[model samples]
Structure formats: C-alpha cells, structure tokens
Target: MTALDVPGIRQVGADAFTWLSAHRDAFALGEDALTEDGHVDATWKPLGELAQTCASVCAVTTPADPLHAPAAALLDFAWLQTGRGELFPRLQRLEPFATYPLEVYSVFASAGLRHPGYEAAAATTARTRGWRSVEQDPTRRLGVLKAERRSGIRRPERAAPLLRRTWLGGLPEPWTFERSSGYALTHVVFHLTDWGRAPAGLPAGLAAYLTHWLPSWLDTCLDAGLWDLGCELVVVAASLPEPPDPALLRDVWPRIARAQLPSGALEQQAPQDGADTEPDFLRCYHSTLMAAFAAARTVTRLPGADGPGRPPAHDGRHRHRGPGEHSEHRERRERSGPSGPRGEGVPG
Candidate 1:
C-alpha cells in the first residue's frame, strides 16, 4: 500500500507535536513582537514559511491528497498577508494567524492586512514598537494576495456576527472547541468512530465538504471549548496497536474541557434568526474524517481493486482469501506457481 493508504498516517497526533516542536525555530520569526494576546508586532520572516510548515506537517502526517496543495498554498498566502512589515505591528497582527480555527479571512484580519482601515492599526502597532521603516518586497506580498484570490476558498469574516456566533458564553477569543496533534493512525480510528456515529440522512455532498476543511475546523472547536481536548486526542490515538493510553488522557484532561454547551448552541436554541444553523463539532469531525477516508482510499490500491501498483497479498490481513473462493484461488496459484516464468511470477 502507498503511504496514503497506511491508516497510521491519518492518526497524526504525536508526530505533529514532534514536527511542530522541531520546527519551532522556523516559526519563531516575530516572537519578540508578540503581545500577551498572541499578536505579532513585527515581520522578521516571510509568512510563507509558516504556511509551508503547516502544509508539510499536514501532508507528511495525514492522508491528505490533492486537496493539500491548495490548502497549503492558501495558508501560505494568509500567513504572509498577516505579517506586518515591522516587528511591533506584526506582533499585534499575529494573533489571528497564531490562534485556532484557522479561517482564511481571519488570517488577513489578524495581520491588519484586510481593508484600508486595518493599515492604521498595523501602523500604530509598528510605531509603538519603534519600527519606523519596513523594507518589504511588494511583489512577495502581492504573490500572497494573488494566491488567496485564486484559491477560491472562503475565509471567515471578522465581523461582529461571526464573532458572536463563535463566542461560547464569554469563552476566550479564538477558542478551539477541540485541539489535537499526533500520528495519522489516531485520525483513522477517530474517523471510523465518527463515521459510525454519524446521524442518519446526511445529504450526499456533506462528506465532500468535511474532508476539505475538517482539520482547521477541528482546531476551531478545540479553541472554542466546544469539545474537550483530551477527548479529541483520545479519539485520534485510539487506532494504535495497543488500546488508547489512559496516561495520555489523564495528563491532558485537566487542560481540556468537560462536555459543555458550546457558545453557539444557545443561539441555535434562541428564536427568530432565520439563518441556517452551524453544525456541531461532532458532525463536523465525522464529516471531515469520512471525506478524508474516501480521499485516502481513492489513492490506494486495494484488494479486488485493479491497479499497476497493487499491494502484495501477504503483508496485511486484507489479503486473506474467503471461504470457497480460497479453493479456486489456491488452485490457480498452485498451477501458476509450478510452471510460472522465474522472473515474471508473483512472489510466493
């Protein structure tokens, strides 16, 4: 099987943590300019590096396929656009970029790169930090703008309405209802459980939508406190050869939330809005993983599925022949094995 088909890749919990820790230096560009609130006041490095790091981590660890390219490109643009040229403004601007629920629009909003008015705030932040001049390459910035426009991905708008929708009862800003990082195998197990729990009667297109944006949204839920972080980690890490680790859950549970109503839940329950309700984290998680599962399978060579690079039968349990079918398959194998061409024959 290809790397894409190895369920372990989907469970990217520990691996993602390790990757991020290793690359912490790469992400440390404006650490000096960051405020207590998570903003970046400077632009010491190109934002592209952050995007590349996120994309590479996702691609190498997850079963992400064709969709990863565009996602990565979009993130790259967002990161660059948000980094103010000077150090101080960059710190104030970095909050949205560094925060959870990585929406496309928020990247711009966080960096004070969106609209004419935001420039004033960015400039003010920069000035406060005593960074008078910023020598940025306009072309590099333009490239990010161009890519974001081309991607056609919808970014979250930083309007009051969106904020109100996200606020879970005075919960902190940029709250993730859930958050997790680790191996891809954890993701697969979580995906299976999520799939099994899917409520009946979802439209056919739902799965497709979830796969493309699940990771970011899950980050949002974690940040928003809609779900417990330990639960997410547990769900993800469930796929290991051994049962899920109790110690892992115990360690993180204090930081994770208990089951609680999301801030948005009250709004849905309230009357007269007339807007289509946002789906809960459970639905979002399930939808994303299901789509990922389907996407991963698309790139894999499964048994009974014809392909140039089909997997050898002996490596995994999936290769086992069924009753009745085994007899004929064995007969064919025996006949073929005894007289097959030495070099051309399939391996025993």
Candidate 2:
C-alpha cells in the first residue's frame, strides 16, 4: 500500500509555518513580487494566499500536534496586519497580481476563523468596481470575469449576461486557461467551487467538460511534474458534484509521494535532467500543503471519497526511478475561517 506520506505532510506543514513565519514580512501587504521590496504600502495579495495555506494545513492536521496553534496564529497575524481590514484599500489597488476579491477573504471566512478586521465592504466594493470595468471595456476582462465569479460577493451584474454564455466558454482542453501563476486553469474550476463552497458557481457546461477531461488533466500535470498545480486540480477534482475517476486519483498519489524529500518538502515541480535549480522549502510549501489537504480529505466528502490516515495501494506509475529522475532530489512537502464558528466542511 502506498498511501500519502503523513509524516511528510506534518513536516512540510511545520516547515511552511516556520519559513512563512520567519519571512511573513516578505509577503506583507505591499511587497513587490519580483523585487520583494520591504514594507511599502501593503497592497499585495500573497499574504492572503499564504494565510489560506496556513489555515488549510491546520484544518487537516490533528489539533493536538504542536504546530496547530502556530498555524492558527499565522492567520491571526495576517488579520492584524491588515488593521482589522483597512489595508485592503491598498491591497485592492495592486490588482490581479496576487489578489482576488471573494477568494482572498473567503479562505479565512470559509474556515470559520475570525479576522475581526475582515472588510465585507472592501470585498463588495472591489466586486462592484470590477464589474463596471468589465462593462465599460470588455476586451481585457478575462481576469475580471474570474475575480468576480470568485469574489463571492455576487456575480458582477454587468458581466452576468456574457458570463453564462461566451465569457468562459469553449475551454474544452487542459491548456485553455493558462493566464498566470502555477494554477491558472485549475483555479477556474476552483473559483467555481467558491473555494470549495460546493461548486455553487460551476456552470453545467464547464462541469460536463471537466467530467470528460479531468482525468487526463491530472495525468498531464503529474507527468509534467507541476506538483503545485496538480494538487490544486486534485482539490478541484475532489470538489466535483460526482466523484472523479478513482483511477485518476490513484495515479497521482505515488508520483507525489515518490517526489517527497526527507524534510517533508515536495519539490515545486518534477526535476528535469541537469536542471540547475535546487529544491527549496519555500517552493515546495504550497504543493505540500495541497497534498496534505487531499490526503486529509480524499477519504471523506471531496468527490464523496476518502483516502486519509492510512496506506493506499501502489500502481504502475510507481516505476523504478533513477537518481535525479524526477526533481533529482527535491521531494517533500490549514484551518478555519473567520467569524461565527468552526466550519463543518472543506475550506474553500
């Protein structure tokens, strides 16, 4: 049986919290993505993503573990950093780079954690403004369409007519939505799930398209060593109203497990021959978290399946690998929401 690397999950989660905690300031409200200039204005969105991962790791991990409290604290710090939510004015100003409307804050809200400073007004305002921008000029609204769909505030009224039809139509392939970041196309599916809010936003056509194509998508991403994106898709697959193909889910595990490192960091991607970049913990963090989240939940409601806390059987994909085969040595690698009470389901 091959099951997920539970210890690896724990270590990666620990490493992420440690690395992120030490470098949390790097993801401060306004730090530049490429240059990472320090403490400027707090307008960026990486922190929101970071906080989401932290909350996610905490949610799956046993609460008795030592890292649980620290993970929860990370969310708290982020909430405080936003001045109880005032910094979003600055955060929204940056736009489309690392932040999204509903998706950003929803990460915390879904987990039922508290961020007293959460600004419903800011999220709503961003949603309202983005809809107007899409209406006035439809040419560059791909990003806007996605943000509004994910904003969770409401579908942008202006784009609503187009959204149900031509907006995101015809993406019948895996490579169709490659905008930016590691998980471009996968996130389209994610946003539809409202960050795992139950695929409330997934259009029937898109869902049908995914049902036909998702298994292969998982394979291609795995074969390509895009671990980060693959796991995101795993979560995407899990959120589908019907379960994903068991064969597809079974195939992804060993590839991910084999790539894991002793320290618990899963390499950000599969290694290529003579690849110069070394596997780094920071790079491995997101992928590792996703894997843990999948392992923690695959055994439950996600796709209405479960694969947690135990060993899973191996398969053909677990072929013998030579040294430096996949990432050549990189391997390895959540939460609550803000508000009323601890959430009861997947953290969207």
Candidate 3:
C-alpha cells in the first residue's frame, strides 16, 4: 500500500506479523492440544494477521512526545500484541472490562467490537446483567447491554489522562498536517469511537446539542494535547468540520516526512525495550489501528475511511432548541462535563 500522511491517519509495515506464525509451535506444546483452558489455538487466526498490519503502522508512523503519554499508551498496546500465544487470548478476554484508557484504546482499535462475533460474544453478558441499554441521558441511549467479563477495570485509567491534561494544559505537535484542526478532531473522534466505544448514532435531541458542543470537545483534545503530548489527538480534532490554518500545516509536514524510516517502513521503529514513553504510546495506538484496519480490509474488503465515520446527516439548517428542552442541559455542558448524549448502535 502507498504511504499515508493524512493529519489524523498513520501507516504501518506489511510484514510485522511473521513472528506470530513462526512461533505457533511453541504454543502447541501445552496440554490437550490447543483447546486446553490455558492453551491457545483460536488466538492464532486473527493475531498473526493483526501483527503484520500493526508492525507496518508502527514501522511507519511518527513517534509521540512527552506530553501524549496516553497516545503513547495506545502505541504500546499494539506492540504487546505482536506475538501470538495465550497472551493474545488473555488480553482479548480482558479487553471489555479494562478500565485503563490505554487498554480501552487498544481493545477498541484491535478487537472485533464491530464484527458480529463480538456482538454475539457480548450478548450473554448483557442478558445476565439485565443492562440491555444504558441511558447516560434521557433522550439518548447506548446499547452496552451485550456484556463480557473483562478484567482490570480501573477508573484511574481514564482519570490519569484527564488529570494530566487538567494539570499540564496541552501537548506539543509531533507531526504537522495540511488540515491540522480537522485532522485532530478526526483522531479524537476515532480515539473515542475505538477506545470509548461511542455509540453509532446520536439521538435527535442530543444531536442538536453535539452539533453545538462537539467543537469544544475537539478544541479540548487539541489544546490538551499541547499539555499532555498526543499531537495525533490534536491533529485529528483539528480536522473537523472547520478547516485548519494553512500556516500550521506548512510548518509541520517536514517533521512528518523526516519521521519515516529509510525504507519507508514505519512500524515500531522505536525499540520495544525502551521505557514506555509518549512516542511509544503513539506507536502502540498507531500500530493497533493499522492492524485493525488491515484486518477489516482483509475480512470485509472495504477500503477504510479515516475518523469516526461521519456525523448523522443534517439538512444544513440550524434550528434553535425548543424551550421545552432543558436549557439546563446547555448550562451543564457549558460547565465542562460530557456534552453529547450516548448514541445507540448505527442503524441498519
């Protein structure tokens, strides 16, 4: 595939997964064939394919800086998954309930959340808990009902990024882009969608609120990046409905070009042995998404588009919210909590 340098998008290497297939024999030695409780056979199917894709992205994308530890966290997630064995299955088992934002990010990017198999897997969990639907807001709903037991649920995972950004204020840009603002927004949306499991569509009432409020979320991701260090988030956020500043793009492209390796391969160029830095996190996320996209392409054969897909279609007219709608809703969002309502899955 051609090298990609979009503001919010990154590319990985094509051969990074070879180690998985090559190492399968060691895993087979366990008791009772691959079906044993701890033994891993099924994990091989997607893990190997995913590795090659992740390795490619890690090999290609720009590294993260100090501020975007969360971004780097995403990259590292990918690196850890490159090998095949029980670890892959174990991680998969732990993915859903992972409270760590990085685990969430990794799971969101690489897991089969969108595939029917995932939906099926989660069905039992949802039925058992009787939490078929989650309503964070009255008007909007998210069907997180399909539950699966995931380990390592920690609230601190999300708190860390929020606190870091709250304290640090913004992150530095690692790579430049032609459409920085729009690109940054796209990454934020993608990150949220992949990691946060944002619902597919917003409710009508919440849609109105989001149209007005999302720009701020985009801004937060961008400005926060200046403090936290994940230019990818900022770049994706910057690349939203509004365009980015031309001068900013002109200044950043050279850094992106230089970030690439000599062979134009950009998967995990940084040593895996290094301490988990922001760059490492970015590589992890980049690799994971690259792997997911590659898997999506291989399985579905659809050319992938960047970002969280598109917002629901609008007629292009902005209407004022009816007075009956809670004006307090606006005020609460203005106070800086979650602005938009959770969405249900994308409609057929």
Candidate 4:
C-alpha cells in the first residue's frame, strides 16, 4: 500500500479537522438540549459525535502529528460544551432509563475526561433491570455495550449473546447487503473492534468476509456519491486484521479526497438545485467528520506509523467464534497483536 498515497490520506484528515475547528461553535447544544422537549438527534447527538471523532483522532495519532493538536483542542471544546462533563448527569437524571446520555458520555470518558458524578449515577442506572432489558436493534445494542465497556460499567456476560444476535455476527449472505444493512454492518464492525482500536476483537472469519466484499460496496458508494457511507466503508477496510488490498484503497482514497470541498466539508451527495434551507454546516458536518475519522484510521495503520500509544486491550467479550473456529485458534490470533449521522444523513 506504499502506493496508496498515505500523505494524501493524512491531508484529508488535516483538512477535515481544520474545517471542524472553524465551525466548532455550530456544534453547541441549544437551550433545550437537556430539557425533556430536546431533540437528541439535533442537539446532544452531534456534539457527542464531534467528541467521539476528535477522541479517535487523538487516540490514534501522537502529539507531534499535525492532526493531533486540533483534535485534542476539539475534544476539549466538546467536553466544555457538556459543562465540563456536568451536563451528562443532569441529562441522566431527567431520563434515568435512557441510554443516550451514557452513550454520549462514554466518548469523553474514554478520552480521560471523566465526570465522577455522572459515572456514579450511570453505574447505578446501569445496574437496574430496566437498563439491562431495554430493547434495541442488534447493531445499536452492540454500540451500547461498547459504551458500557468504555465507561467501566460493562457486564461482560452480555456481550457475547449480543454479538450473536447482530446481522454481521451471523455472517449472512453477502448479496443481502443494501443501504440500511450497509449502515448496520459498518456499525457492527465499529462496535466489535472498538472503532478500530482492536482489530483482533473481530473474528478472523468476519475479517475475511469484509476483506472480500468491501471493495464492491465501496465502489458502489463512490459511484453514487454517497460520501457518508463511503467513508464508513473505508474505515471498515482499514480496521481489518490485515490492511485491505493496496490497489483498492489507492483507487478509493483519491475519490474521497476529491469529494471533500475546498472548505474541507463533505456532503452525503452533491447539492441539488434549491436544496432545502438546512444550513450548509448542518448538512455537511457529519460526512466531514466521517472523512476525517476514516483518514486518521487508515493513516495510523500504515507501516512505520508514529503514534506512541499502542492499541488498547481487546475486550475478549467481543470476540466471536465462527463455524469450526476453535478456542485455541482464536487465542493464537490474540497473541499476534492489536490493531453518525446526524444531520448529514442516517443515524450512525
């Protein structure tokens, strides 16, 4: 993949972060953000996503890397927006049975911006039967479980059964893929791999399955100008146990780079005549964030990458055993080494 233009990929992340930093205030939660009438999608969700993306950038890149400082700054900005991690507890109190607050706060927690009050309250909430029994789509369940793990409240026994229920966990027929399923599959991978920090967290069989099919899905997204989903697929490829085909990535990266506007923003699709008056910032923010995430993830995985931090410990609860894959074989792989959508489009 030396021919994959690693610098170009790095540029994509740099440019996207620059854009996000310029428009940082646009992510501020509104007055009703924590109120019962608040629209989580429009308010807390975007800010949380901003925090999560910034956290990913900081986690994967060292301080010396150009992308690191701005990302760190943005993460700090996002934490402040939550009142230095104070708002989460307030939101949790208002919706004690709800999980979004915990989900959102987990990003900050993972980045070391903990809120003792919120964590205490969340731990209590998590132990309740209501919290444990809340039904969610399988893909979403994986995300909640991940959030629990990140927040130090995870119930280890729950993860394996949840994994088995996900569509990707089953390794369903490849032809069943579609837009909705596409999003589901990408998220399943994200949660299982802890957003690419632990590639071994994904079963070897699933890695092979994605490696074989991601190219075609990526091409389709590129052809349709689906920047949001395309960036996600790029992340999936980069997250695999082995990097994807150099040729596939080499071809795909430029198309995504070109999709980025001069402002560093990327839209789900090209704007059409008289597109609704939704602010351009709102329309473009999520895709831009995804692009940065995809770029940062891909670059850090390249040979001789310089991040000082190693991947975090893989959550053994996340590992799946595919047909005929034995416990010993899985353990051997473990010894080898670690590896949105608001607004802009679908809810990721």
* Model 2 Cα shift for residue 94 (angstroms): 8.9
* TM-score-better candidate, 2 vs 4: 4
User: For every model shown, what is its TM-score relative to the native structure?
Assistant: 0.22, 0.60, 0.31, 0.86
Point to the candidate with the largest TM-score: 4
- Indicate the worst ten consecutive residues by lDDT in candidate 3: 138-147
Candidate 3 ranges beyond 4 A from true positions = 1-118, 129-188, 191-231, 267-348
Among the numbered candidates, top lDDT falls to 4
CA error at residue 132 for candidate 2, angstroms:
1.4
Each prediction's Cα lDDT score? 0.29, 0.49, 0.29, 0.76
Best of the two (3, 4) by lDDT: 4
What pairs collide in candidate 4? 341-348
What TM-score number comes out for model 2? 0.60
lDDT of 1 by residue, 212-330 (tens): 22333333333333332223333333222232223322322222212211221111111234344544432333222222322222222222222212212222111111111223323
lDDT tens digits by residue: candidate 4, 1-348: 442454368788888988899999989988999789888888988999898887777777666677777877888788888888889888887999888998998988777777777888898888888987898888788888888878888574466777778777787775555666677888889888877887888988888878766676666666667788888888899889896666666777888887787778888665556243333877789889999988888877777676434323333111111102223323432332221111122755
Q: Each model's number of backbone clashes?
A: 48, 41, 57, 1
List candidate 1 stretches off by more than 4 Å: 1-64, 84-89, 92-231, 234-276, 279-348
Over 178-229, each residue of candidate 3 has an lDDT whose tens digit, in order, gives 1233233333333333322232321233224334443344333323222122
Candidate 2 residue-wise lDDT at 178: 31
- TM-score of candidate 3 versus the correct structure, residues matched by position: 0.31
